[model samples]
Target: MSVLRSGSPHRPARSLATVAGILLALVSLLLGLPGTAGAAATQRAPEPRHPEQDWAGSQIARHEGTADGGAPPAAPLASVEGVDVSSHNGNVAWSTLWNSGVRFAYVKATESTSYTNPYFAQQYNGSYNAGMIRGAYHFATPDTSSGAAQAAYFVSHGGGWSKDGKTLPGALDMEYNPYGATCYGLSAAGLVNWMKDWFATYKARTGRDAVLYTSTGWWKQCTGNSAAFGAVNPLWIPRYGSSAGELPAGWGFHTIWQYTSSGPTVGDHNRFNGAMDRLRALANG
Candidate 1:
């Protein structure tokens, strides 16, 4: 009944067509269809990550060995036997490990001042009760907190060394990152300085040089194979083979070698590079 104006009869259809075009564009974006901005965004690579879990050799085997490979079939050498354990090794049968001839152990104590192994007391005390020379280790997260702060937290928790013959010096476990970049996003110089802070602070508190745990490849790639701590810190090198392999730069010899990630009886077993007396000597000092 309305008087027609030019282009008026088609107005509703044009509006509906415009709305349909908008809806189609939105659908394309949601679907990340080709030639769309959303598609471009989707095509960008994802950031690197994993569920972070810091431990002894957590990332070492992954980066250093064949995919998911276990320790070599070769039998361990005749040396002072040891083990390194973390919270994952819950309620360790310390007596069984002792019976299996594990004379020494290093238990994960703290990580980056934020995490204290939930099984720390059980593992640390239990290992000692079974007559194994046990030490606490701190998994270094250089990117999370200052080295000094982390060191203090470690000492306050359980990473303390004593002259007690049954307790070995606390060790610092510095290896590849489990969650992010291999070097924890720190440059070689920065990482070196960070560790110096840790060493100095730990020495100041416990009057002991903390043992250093790292792989040769990581040391080279991450720290430029800096040998600054080699003269003081005992190196705990990890290589799952018949031999300990070439050590990282600066150390004349490795003190302890984590030779197997998959031990027949215990968890990960190590071999102190000497006899029981020398093991006791490390504990005493």
Candidate 2:
């Protein structure tokens, strides 16, 4: 007769149920039960990051998607057309590019002190032999070695410049670091100093300033848009857009604009700021 317990509230029972649910969740998580959060998290391996795949504009294209389709903008009547290739391009058909009216080219030659482009000779020499004013570029990996050391390595490889009217100055492909931190884990001031070392060493070795290939966005994030190298380094800005778009802090004008990665022919398409004479003048320097 005293068994009637309906007068009591269910708060305690509800609390016990809540505790039981929590325990069950914990058990599933610990066991990585099928269709649970832990299973989803542990299912796949992360993609491994590797070098050599880090070529010119590779990071930029990853961060900022390129326009691979649609009608390309008409080349400026007074502008010179160009292309840039890397080992990723694998022995570019320079003859075909020349027939397509491409007048200049840049080919990646080195990355840090550890790696060199396997197809560099084919791309670098083939472009010149095809009668295009060509140059070599080094993909900067500032995290691995000192800028001066990397510079030495670059010149010892094919990243050397000449005064020949047919050769353009080597370029420092200093875009976002493909392997790690944006500025190679450096402070803004540190980045500037590192660039200084690279430029000095490269100038001493080649007697010509290396061209800087970078995007304005990366410059802002990595170096706080420092204007230190603008005056001394020729800017080769990559902008896949309707126009060349706004440049970084220091450069008032761009020497070359890589407007589209997916051009009609091969490699990334660029435009020299002036006509053929101006292109030759820059090369002669």
Error of 2 at 196 (Å): 0.7
- Candidate 1 wrong stretches, greater than 4 Å: 1-52, 66-78
User: What TM-score would candidate 1 get against the native?
Assistant: 0.79
Top TM-score model: 2
- Candidate 2 lDDT over 231-256, as tens digits, reads 88999998887777889998999999
- Candidate 2 TM-score, C-alpha based: 0.80
Candidate 2's displacement at residue 102, Å, is: 0.4
Q: CA lDDT of 219 in candidate 1?
A: 95
RMSD of 1: 7.8
lDDT for 97 in candidate 1 is: 91
Candidate 2 C-alpha error for residue 195, in Å: 0.8
lDDT of 2 at 161: 83
User: What lDDT does model 2 reach?
Assistant: 0.85
